[model samples]
Target: MDLASYAELAIELVNSSDPAEDSLRDLDSLQRLLRIRPHLGGRVTRRDLDAMRELRDSLRAVFTAAARGDHADAVDRLNTLLIQHPVQPQLSGHDGQCWHLHLTESGSVPDRYAAGAAMGLAVLISDRGVDRLGVCAAEGCGNVFFDTTVDRSRRHCSPQCAGRSNGIP
Candidate 1:
């Protein structure tokens, strides 16, 4: 998926506030989605997990800024992240994947994941602009979301979250 798609998925992965029995499971599911492309790196170590957590926080900030229509701020935040961990696009493998860019150099899983996400966000901001990012409107749940829907009316990070917020027991 492109940056826009990845960004949306990233938002969904981190914004959940649920602390129930299934919350960790839900998080794991979301992480799988984010790491769909093996190039983004999969869970491999404690440092990787920590890096993912940091990326989650950074992504949250990006989305929150976007929700407020703060494009400059969001871009600045992305830039800072990029500086800390620069990305160099490289071509590898030959399964007709055809030289898709990678976000990080060969290193830790977390570094790879963070680089991939940063690269995705960079693409999103550069191509579609940062206005596409958003936050869930559900009261008391400030989860962030990416507006990938055709109508761009996405309010909640997930359907379940949306339903719960709406009192749709």
Candidate 2:
């Protein structure tokens, strides 16, 4: 899988829940997330769901710190997670695609997921700077985002949020 796509796993996990509601509220929700991220699949259970929730909170803090200009805190958080959930890198290719780097398919479902997400975030921060990580500016919509804009002016998580913030709907 693409490393950047793995970074998206981190963003998705952080956005999965907020003060208003939680998408990963049950095993089915967790399964749904896994379905989208086929690279991170295993025999998940309720325990894994709880673990993922905890990981989500941890990742959110990282993004929050980065988006707020606390680069040290963000790096520290990613480092801690990297240490906690080490990933083994390997080259893989299938479906007639070119060979690329991928994290090992070992460990429990949560661990594997955490490893990829944390590693992806770490790589992104190191490569593009922590400012690329941001939280949505839309009111009451605090979803995190990996800003890929040329000018780095992305403020909202999605165009829908931007429109909603601008009263377009």
Candidate 3:
């Protein structure tokens, strides 16, 4: 996925309540997890999609730390990543794409994607609060999620994830 789309998806994937479910099985699952709000006719790939999964795992760490209300740990993790894989934003796409910056080079692996997403979340937490990260309260599923809700009371990634985790019949 493109950088913008990756950013959008990062928000949703980190906030999803069911990381182990079918929603995460498709190529677009990464986009969905990051909440990219896919467009029709968009091409997706799973052959080289390992980066997306890596993104998921890395995000899981951040969300898990956030869920526990440990801002220090989350920040430290993100910072370590930044130090290890520093990136500078530059414009390269021919489409102009608003001339936005990217945290990693083109064709980056999942690690780059994960680092970028974590960096974004870290910024959000530093500016907003650690309460933005959350987890499903359902019985079996302990998936991590991002709370973009204005009220900050979101409890699950989706109704289905919530119901399944809660043992609702």
Best by TM-score: 2
Alpha-carbon TM-score of each model against the true structure: 0.72, 0.92, 0.62
Comparing 2 and 3 by lDDT, which wins?
Answer: 2
lDDT of 2 at 43: 77
Candidate 1 regions with alpha-carbon error over 4 angstroms: 1-9, 21-37, 41-43, 149-152, 160-169
Q: How many clashes does each candidate structure show, in the order listed?
A: 0, 0, 10
Error of 1 at 137 (Å): 1.1
Off-target runs (Cα >4 Å) in candidate 3 are: 1-58, 106-108, 163-169
Ranked candidates, highest lDDT first = 2, 1, 3
Candidate models: Cα lDDT each:
0.65, 0.88, 0.60
* Model 3, span 50-158: residue lDDT tens: 5455555666676677788887886676676566555555555546555565665543444455556656665666666777877777766666666778888789867
Error of 1 at 126 (Å): 2.1
Candidate 2: what lDDT? 0.88
TM-score of candidate 1 to 2 decimals? 0.72
Poorest stretch of ten by lDDT in candidate 1? 16-25
**Candidate 2 backbone collisions, by pair:** none
